[model samples]
Target chain A: MFFYLIDVFGTMAFAISGVLTAINKKMDPFGVFVIAFVTAVGGGTLRDVLIGRSPVGWMRDLNYVYVIIAGFFLAVIFRKKLDKLRTSLFFFDTIGLGVFTLIGLEKGLEINLHPVICVALGTMTACFGGVTRDILCNEIPVIFRKEIYATICILGGCVFFLLKALHVPDGLLYILTSGVIIATRLMAVVFKWSLPPLSRD
Target chain B: MFFYLIDVFGTMAFAISGVLTAINKKMDPFGVFVIAFVTAVGGGTLRDVLIGRSPVGWMRDLNYVYVIIAGFFLAVIFRKKLDKLRTSLFFFDTIGLGVFTLIGLEKGLEINLHPVICVALGTMTACFGGVTRDILCNEIPVIFRKEIYATICILGGCVFFLLKALHVPDGLLYILTSGVIIATRLMAVVFKWSLPPLSRD
Candidate 1:
């Protein structure tokens, strides 16, 4: 139940982020909804497809669609007040990332995929929405260049496995893994930690 | 057997286009291969996933990877001559669009999806590789803004359903549908046809 709440909220946060970006790009209503939907579910869709899960998570569940719609309208209506809520939005976004990573990792494990692939999936679920949104908006994906975002998800995935191997209880396991991801990301931002560019130029 | 050949050749052409774009962007070798592979198979992957087909087309077959690799090296070796082969490449690309559209439409039909959705899938399969490529290259997709590229695919898709409804023979249907797509694209280019921008400014 708790995980479900996290999933819904995280989806909304991601959708809002996508909606805001689309609006800023001056996209039409159709484009805005497309971006929002993709941002909220694109990562999980990719992961599920790769892992051979049919119909994907979102297609099977209608709540994601509802949340994305809500998030889009919230962004559109609250556009003027968004700048002032940047810090709070960041907090929600961070929590969403952590929650999403855990969800992805769990899904990967259920499918009996390799740990490495699971980690990759986790990171992808937490980051690929923004990547798709940026792509649709014709910009460089911020996660690919600007921050330690995906790296945090990878770390959280590692923590998840480590706890599982130690026979941690499910509830604690979820909290610890998500907490680690959130903390790692917060610290990365506070310290301005980032990956080096592939090209110096 | 014929469709298989078209698929392989189309994959190569798309990969070559991706390689050339990556080289133009001055990306490293790894990035080049990534872009090429995505450009070659990303659309099909998207279509398969959306339709609940898992392990996607490329993952189920190793030939795609091999073809992409071959196409990448070929492009690298022939970089200096590529500009001169622009007309030929354009022909291959147009043929690829038609072939891919047919494949996607057939897949959708096999799944018993709506005709309109089938046409959409066909268009996506024909155009999304370039969209993915352009996004990875950090640019607006040329298809979304420039020529009547996707428009041609949609027209071809409409023709396909029209012919199907008329009970066209299988071989002739395939040939005519692909021919229509190719001809429309070529004519659009020759006549400099394009869609109006959503934003006039």
Candidate 2:
């Protein structure tokens, strides 16, 4: 139940980020909503499809769609004041990154996918929504360019498996993994840490 | 046997297109290959996932991967002469679009999805490889902006259902649907037909 709420919060946060990107692109309302929907569900959808899970997470549960709708409305209504809420939004987004990574890792383990693939899935879940959002808005995905976003998720995945190898309790395993992800992300942003682009020459 | 050949041809064409696009973007060799791989299979992958097909088409078949590799090398070797082969390349691409659309439609029907959704799947399959390619290269998808590409696929899908309702035989149905898509796309390109953008308020 607690995890579900975090999933909802993460979906909402991703949707709002999509809304902001679409607005910046000067897209129509219909376009805005579509962007928000994809941004919220795209990552999980990709993960689900790759792992052979049918109908996907969002289709089976209309709550995700509703949450995206709610996020869209909230974003549009408070567009002017969003600047003031940046920190709060960032906080939620960081939490989302952690939770989503854990969810992906768990789903992968459930299907007995290789640990490397599971880590890739975890990073993908936490990052690909933003990647899709950027793509729709016609920009190179930030994560691919320089952000430490996906790296943090990858690190968290490693932590999850490490704890599991130690026979850590399931509950504690989840908490520690997410905690590592959330803290790293927060620190990365605070310290303005970024990956260096490969040299062109 | 013939349809499988067409599918392979289409995948190669899409991969070649991806190579061209990545080259234009001045991406590294690895980037070029990655773009080509995604452009070749991204649409079918997307379709497979949406409908709950597991393991995806490519993962189940090594031939697709091999074809993409062949296409990549062929494209790179012939890069300088590609301009002179524009017509040939476009012809292959058109054939791919038609064949891919039919494949998507058939897959959707196999799953007993509604006709409308099936048409959507078909259109998505026909155009989304190019869309994914453009997105990765940081450009707006040409189909979304103003191309008769997806529209032709949708029309072909409708024609497919219309024929089915008329009790068209399966073999003829496949040919006719793909024929309509291929012919209309050829005409659209020859006549420079394009969709007009919606007026900004």
Candidate 3:
């Protein structure tokens, strides 16, 4: 129940991020809505496809679409305030990474997938949409170029199963795993950390 | 055998088209290869997922990857000549559209999908990468804005079935359908034609 609440908030964060990207790209409202919708659900859709889930999440739940469209308008109406709170937006995105990863892991476990596959799914759920958005915006994704983003999601998924193996209390494990991803990503960005680029000959 | 040949040609054309988009976007060579591969195959990937095909085509056939990469370099080497030949590019793209629609219809029929769904898939196969390219390039897709591109594919598919029901010869039907799409698209371009805009308001 608690996880579901946090999951929706994460969706909101993702929606805002996509809307901002479209606005920055100078897209009209219809274009902004399209980008935001894709950014918020693109990862989830890909996961569902790989797992052969019928109907997909947003298709099954109208609320997901509603929330994304609402997020778009909220961002547009409050663009000035959001612009002033760039740090807050970053925090929101980090929180989103945690929420998406945990839920994705849970979904994989529910489906009785292998641990490795579940971790990969978790990483994809948290990262693919941002990658899509960045590519569409004509930039290399931040996950690939800067900050320790996807790695944090991967590590969180690892910690999730490790805690489960030790049979840690469920609620505590969820909170701990999410906290780890958020902290790792936020710290890496704050401290200007990054993965090494591929060697240039 | 002829159908397979047409399929390969369509795939090659779409891959080259994708690589050119990546070049225009100024992506790295690896990025160019990736975009080209996905652009060529993205619609088929979606169709496969929808129809529950296992592992997907490229996963089943690694040659698709090698072909895409080769196409990428071929584009790079001939970029200047290609840049000067928009008309010729349009010809290849139209040929690709005709072949892709046939492939999509065949795949759907093999899977026993509804005829409506098959036509939709045919339209998708012919138009989706172009739509994806425009989205990635941050422009409204020409499919949604310009001439009756997807419409031609749909019409050709309909014509194939119409001729089949009338006991048309197999070879003649194939040629006639492909010719219809190619002629439709070329006529639209040469005649300054377009679909009615949803609204300019």
Candidate whose DockQ is highest: 2
Query: What lDDT does each candidate get?
Result: 0.85, 0.87, 0.79
CA lDDT, candidate 2, residue B122: 90
Q: At residue B153, give the lDDT of candidate 1.
A: 79
Return the interface RMSD of model 1.
5.1
**Regions more than 4 Å wrong, model 3:** A1-44, A51-127, A132-201, B28-31, B85-87, B196-201
Off by over 4 Å in 1: A1-53, A57-131, A139-201
Model number with the top lDDT:
2
lDDT score of residue A95 within candidate 2: 87
Q: Report the C-alpha displacement of residue B40, candidate 3, in angstroms.
A: 1.1
lDDT of 1 by residue, A9-85 (tens): 89998888887777677665555666787899988888787777865677556677778889988887787788787
| Model 3 lDDT tens row, A166-201 | 999988998999999998888888787766542212
Residue-by-residue lDDT tens digits, candidate 2, A1-201: 999999999999999888877777766565566678788888898898778787677756668877998999998888778879989888888888999999999999999999999999998888889998887888888888877989899899999989999999999999999999999989998899998888989
- Flag clash pairs in model 3: none
Local lDDT at A188 for model 2:
91
Task: For candidate 1, give the lDDT.
Answer: 0.85
Model 2 error, position A55 (Å): 2.3
DockQ of each: 0.16, 0.19, 0.08
